[model samples]
Structure formats: C-alpha cells, structure tokens
Target: MGLDRAASIADLRLKAKRRIPRFAFDLVDGGAEAEVNLRRNEEAFEEVLLTPRYMVDVSRIDTGTEVFGESFAAPFGMAPIGMLNAFWPDADLTLARLCKRQNVPYVASSAASTTLEALAEAADGNGWFQLYVSSDDTVTEGLIARAEAAGYEVMMVTADVPAAGKRDRDIRNQLSVPFRFTPEVVLQCALNPRWALTSLKHGTPNVANYADLLQSATSYADVQKTLITPSFDWESLRRLRDRWKGKLLVKGILHPQDALRCAEMGCDGVVVSNHGGRQVAFGPPTIEALPAIAEALGGRIPILLDSGVRRGADFVRAKARGADFVLAGRALAYGVGAGGRAGAERAMEILLLELQRALGQLGVPRFADVTRSALSDMPASQD
Candidate 1:
C-alpha cells in the first residue's frame, strides 16, 4: 500500500510485516515467554481515556518539550532496538540519521549492529548509548569509557535482562547471530528471497558492540551461554555510572522505589520500561508504573516511558498521566524495516502530526499543559 493509505501506526506495522522477513519481524514483535506482560502493556494504553476541554482556543499548539537538558521538536523519541540490521539493511544508521534530522533522541543498543562512534557522528553526538552490563567489571568499565570517548551525552545502563528472555520464535526459526542453517531453516530462508539475498550479500550478522570482545559463537548453545547469565546486578550499574562521565540513565525500571533509588544513586533519569515487555512475562505495565515512579522521582529526575506506544494519543496519555516523554519501540523499527531512512522519517512524521492533532483537539496550548487533570483513572483490571 502507498504511504498515503498508511494513516496510522497499525497501517505502518502491516506494511512492515509484508516487507521484512518473518524471523526479523518476530525479533521486533516478540516478547518474553507467554507474553502476558506484553499484552498487558498494550491494554494499559486503552484503559486510560482523555477528557478534552472544549471552547478553548488552542489554534497554536506547542508540542515541543525539553528532556535530558536538550530541547526536542516533540515530547516523544525513538527507543533502541538491538540487531536492527537483521530486520533490514543498515537499519541502525538509517534510524540514527532520521532522528538527527527530526531533532529527537535516538538510543543505541549494545546489541545493535552499528558502533557507537558511527551512531554518535550520524546523530551529531546527540545519541544515547544503552549498555547491557557484563559480569566482568573490567569489560564493563572499558565499554563505558569507550562510550564516553565516542561523545555519547547520555549513558543508559539497562538493568533488566539479567538473563535473556525465553523467546520461542527465535528458537523455532533458529535465528542466531552467526546462523547455522539446517535443511528446514535453509528452505525457510529460500522462501523469503530478499532476506536470503541480503544475508548472503552482507554475510551473517554479528553483534556489533560485542564483535571485538565476543566472537561469533560456533553454536546456538554457545551464544546462549554468553548472552544469558545471572551475573548482572546493581553493582554493575554502580560501576557503569562511576566509569562513564555523562548523563546516567537507568532503563527497565518499573517500581517506584527503584526509580527513587536510581535518583539516590545519582542517575539523571529513569526510563519506565519493561524492556518493551520483552523480558518479563508478568511484570507491571510501563504505564501502570509511571504515576508512582513520577511521584517518586518528584522532579529530581526525569521519567521517560516506552512500550505499546503507537499513536499520538498514546503520547498524550503517557504525558498526561506523568511521563515527561514517551518512547516508541516497534513503531519506529517497523518503519525502518518497511522502507529505510525514509520509513524512519515517515514514522516520526506520523507521530508529530498525530501529537499536533491531538493537542489541537484537546484544547491544550502546549505539551507542558498536559496534566493529570486531563486523564481519568485507568481501570485496575487493565494491568
């Protein structure tokens, strides 16, 4: 379908599914085992309803907001997805460039296909690097120092994923980094000619950040052993912040006390996320934790949120409830997967327009005016 016909995030997702391979889509779309938390995150968005005010002149709406000591064109930004190139060619750079043009934050994952230097340069040193801490303090310290040298202004240490989630889809597809294809797997790739050709042309994908430190594993079992370990903890976060001289952010916080602890621990911000519901099956929805976390932070630190954010209305819902800004995950990746840099641009464009439209209808003159008064209590059953 044409871009004109793609009026909503759902439409863009549909387009993305058709263009990208099934394995790639599953990586972007799948969550933890059972996916109960994933479904709950989406459901939380629906539970909150906006009660708009009428007869208020809001012809000129300001969607702009400042977060992390930077002014953004809008209150929402792109959330990082690991191994994006596995979905589409050059996905990391494509999205980084798009975010740079749009003047919004773009997070780079440790598991991403591109390096921090490339993303920082492409994004004009405005990008944040999301680090997945290792058990070894020496390796973790070195990575943080490298990120600082790369000119990353924000250092986000992902506290979740102490152990990798049980993803059934990846197991079934046998989609490891250095892929080993059985007869059935080869046939599956052959059915999707574009994915097969790209894999052949580019050579198999490797984890960019870990490429130098951790070579491609000989088998899937080996990959699992290295990636999924129970060694990550609060000490890792302490070491990461101490080593990196930049804005420290803690992602994957879903508890009010945890958010408070982050601020006490000298974190500048905390992203209210459950790793897009990709890590925990029965965890609290990100939206459900926002108000409490925001209250806990009490303006000491910014609380950014992500998960199930697909529409401009979703951004409104998030901001009204307590989130300073919203982060889009699958929406942006799907956009990049569907097209390229253009698709990423289209994704941002759609959200900006939607935010403007929602602001106009809500009679809110500025994004700052969006308050708890604008939102009713979400159903308890929602979470």
Candidate 2:
C-alpha cells in the first residue's frame, strides 16, 4: 500500500496505465511496427541465466559505479523519456529530485516539459541532458549553451531517430506531442478524472527543451514534424561535443563500428540502445550487442546499455557482457506513471536491492566485478 513497500515495476506500470489517458499510456508502452521488438526486449532479459556460487563471504556488496568522472550510487541510471508531463504534471522535476535523492544520474530529454535550467537546478549536479539534434545549427548551439550553463554533468546526444517511428498505438489512440485526445480518448480521460483534473490545473504541457527554438505544438501532428530530423550527422555530433564542456555521451548506438567511431571521435560514452525497441522494428537486443561493442571500445569509452532491462539480473547480464553502466527508460516510466516521485523512488529501491542480492549470489562483492569472463554462454552439449 505504501510507496516503499512496492515490490515491482509492474505494480507501478498498472497504476500508470490506470491514471494516465489511453493515448498517453500507449506512447510509453507501445513500440514501432508490430510490437515484436518490444516483446523481444523484455523476453531477452528473461533469457539470461545466472549461475550462483555459495560458501563465499557474501555478507556485503557494493553497486556503486563512476561514469564520466562522477561517482554514482549504482551502476545504472534513468534514461531520458520524452513527453514526460503527459504522465505527471512535472515529470522531469520529479525524476530530477528522485535522481538526486537516490544519487543516480538522471538524463533529461530534449523534448521534456521542463526547462534545462529548471531541471539542472532541481537535480542539483546529477542532471544529464539528452539532446535531439535540431534541423538548425543555430538552435542546436543555443541548446548546448543552455545545458552547459545549467550545470549538467553530461550531455547525451541521441543519434537514433532520424525520423519518428510509426507507432501504431499512437495512431490508433490519437496521441501526439501536445496530445489532442479524440472524443474516444476524451472519454478515456474523463474516466480517469484524477489525471484530467491534475492536468487541467497545471495547464497544458509545453515542449520545454525547445521552448526558444520553436513554439510548443498543441497537437500530435504538429509535434511529430518538429521533434525529429533526418539530417543529424557526424558533423552535428562533433559540433555538439565542441560546444558542451561536460562529458559528451552518444546514445542509440548498436553497431560495433559505430561504438569504435564514437571513441575515435572523442565522445565520452555510448549507450547501446535500440530506443528500447521504440524506433527500429528489428535489431539485436542491447544485451546481444553489449559484448562486441564493449570489447571494441572497452578502454576507449564508457559503454552504457538500455533495452529490455526489467530487473536486477538484467543489469548483471549487461555488466558481465561488457557494459560499464546500465539505464532503464520504461521501468521509470512505469514507476512515475504509477505513483509519481514515490513510485519512481520505489523503482530505484527495488533495482538496488535486487542488484545487491544478485551480486551476493553470483560470488561477486562489487557489481563491476561481474565481468565478461565471469559469464559463459550455454554451449552445445551431448544429449
């Protein structure tokens, strides 16, 4: 009943689905194409089998990890999600505060409903801004300057999403950027009065990250056109790195060559993500790609991972395979959507506790010690 007692992200996910409108819920829950990738993401996590060892001093374990020169309380952090206000009034602020209290890094989306300065201040020094390259270079420059001035510790440039994915749920539910609910959607909103009243009291959500570059689009159609650009290139990444003083991370990298390219380009890190199965219809899950990418760029740059990370063991799998750090997007969405800051906090607590237990069982004292050699894939055996 209480927030701290929450056991799983699924608990929060159900709550979020109930509180948020159908369209809003679908945006966070649904993925591109036939949703095969989405299902595979979660299934991939379940596929990893851990061999635990006993008779070891497993009384204590440490999950703390340092990335981009800053120590984090855990090996994982929250990945940035767009249109956060759709879930709660000020979802960005909620996540920022929670990240501070939890001491895990919070990456703010470029399409979030809160301003860069506001989130940076709210998150204190734990904020990391996720940048979506704009079509205009001048706009991009200003955004870089804003994040630098806001005291963000890291600047993560999202290199995926050259164009918006064709999410069938969004189309069916009529959910877009500003979220103009159709009559059916309006009825769904009315059914969830708590969400409707709170949303009304706070005023409509604005695209805060692009507040200066463009006016906030009030409809789904308007927002889609403004949110993505197909022309985001290597030059854009170089320009962003040049302007931002903090650690620069490139998100949405899946290719091993691309991971090496980021290292060669002087990027600080690369998040091997398939946009949590939201963008591409098919690809190797982040876990499958972790080892190769990490092996290629292990000493060069921090290899961060996201996608299908539902529980603590998933983190172990990623770390053992090659990831320096892990991140979760939908799980936090489930948390915040389920019960605001308390729910989000519960999600982190659940992860940390589970991770601690997992570390002890695996005969590792430190989370980072669960390295590549600690794991061996199931081999073909005599039947």
**Highest lDDT model number:** 2
Model 2 poorest ten-residue lDDT run: 374-383
Q: Write the per-residue lDDT of candidate 1 for residues 1-383, one digit (tens) a residue.
A: 87666787778788878766677778888888878888899989889898777898988989889987799888877787878888887888888888888888889887788877888888885588888776555656676777888888887877777778877777777776566667876666777777668667876666777686667467655654544346766665676667677889888898999889889878899999998889879889999889888887888988899988888888999988889987888888877766667777777788889889888888897998898777755443442
| Model 1 score (lDDT) | 0.80
Candidate 2 lDDT over 16-66, as tens digits, reads 887888877887898988887888888877777767766889787989898
Please list the C-alpha lDDT of all candidates, in the order they appear: 0.80, 0.81
lDDT of model 1, residue 148: 80
Off by over 4 Å in 2: 1-5, 216-225, 376-383
At residue 212, give the lDDT of candidate 2. Answer: 51
Give the Å error, residue 349, model 2.
1.3
The TM-score values for the models, in the order shown, are: 0.93, 0.93
Clashing pairs in 1: none
